[model samples]
Target chain A: MEARTKAEVLRRLRSVAGHVEGIARMVEEDAYCIDIIRQIQAVQRALAKVNDLVLAQHLRACVTTAIRGEDPEERERVLEEIVEVFEAAQKI
Target chain B: MEARTKAEVLRRLRSVAGHVEGIARMVEEDAYCIDIIRQIQAVQRALAKVNDLVLAQHLRACVTTAIRGEDPEERERVLEEIVEVFEAAQKI
Candidate 1:
């Protein structure tokens, strides 16, 4: 990944870490159900942003390599890897 | 996104299109059940790779923006969007 992109991801992750900590604090304080739910949602959103970043990187790097490679096996392998990640994400 | 990354995604997509065509041919020719399953698996794998690429980008851009923005609303919006996408993805 490019330096800028990497930096962006790291920055986001740092924020997410803080957000998650907030959620933990809320839970500890015996926060109301709605309040807890809201915090959870915040964390989920942060995670989603991270997920998007990773997906873009794979598309640019792995997918490109697979498509341009002369070796048929490489192409198939990359495709397989991509599909696998999607499947995993779906499960999550 | 950078030009190289964009090019990579496009290239991968092109190959996937070809792969899908192959699968269509297999189905058309009354291929064995196993053969059809294999093709489906191949398609799934290709899709997964693409998903990964997109996820990476979101983490880098959207997540970073949310974290850095001073507005609390922007941060909340980004987080919500991320969770929503992941939930949708799971359903699929």
Candidate 2:
């Protein structure tokens, strides 16, 4: 992964971690239920953004390397992994 | 939210907080990008469950109270809130 992307991803993930802890605090304080649910949704949205970043980075770096390399097995493996990722992502 | 639901929600959110922090550690360690994305997806699934619990509690208690109360305005407000939630949720 590029240094810039990794740093950005880490920053986002750390913020997400804090947001989640904040949600827990809200629940502990007995805040309005709808408000809590909205916070949860916000976290989900943030995670989705992180997921996209990681997947894009993977495709650009790791997957590209494997695909352009001289190993047929590695190429096949990377192709299959991409398909698997999309399958799992459909649920999200 | 009810006491039991609140406790469960808090427990889950705390665990989610731990999981998000763990993902940040994975990134810091330069773990595989696909693996990090999968971890992000797992956290999202956890958040969705929390959202469901909070929404169910709201519907059963808060929304029910509003609907059954003498204030028609409160009932309309709650109904609109639910609709808005669903519309937002459709993208997720």
Top candidate on lDDT is 2
Off by more than 4 A, model 2:
none
Local accuracy by lDDT, each model: 0.69, 0.89
| TM-score per model over all chains | 0.50, 0.96
Which predicted model would earn the best DockQ? 2
TM-score of chain A of 1: 0.86
Give me the displacement of residue A70 in model 1, in angstroms: 1.7
lDDT by residue (A3-82, candidate 1, tens digit) is 87799999999998888888889888988989989888777777776777776665555655554556768755655664
Output the number of the TM-score-best candidate: 2
Which digits, one per residue and each the tens of the lDDT, describe model 1 over residues B4-90?
Answer: 667878888899899989888988898998988988887777776776677656545565455455666775565566546655675
Q: Write the per-residue lDDT of candidate 2 for residues A14-90, one digit (tens) a residue.
A: 99989988998899898988888888888888888998889989999999999999999999998898888788778
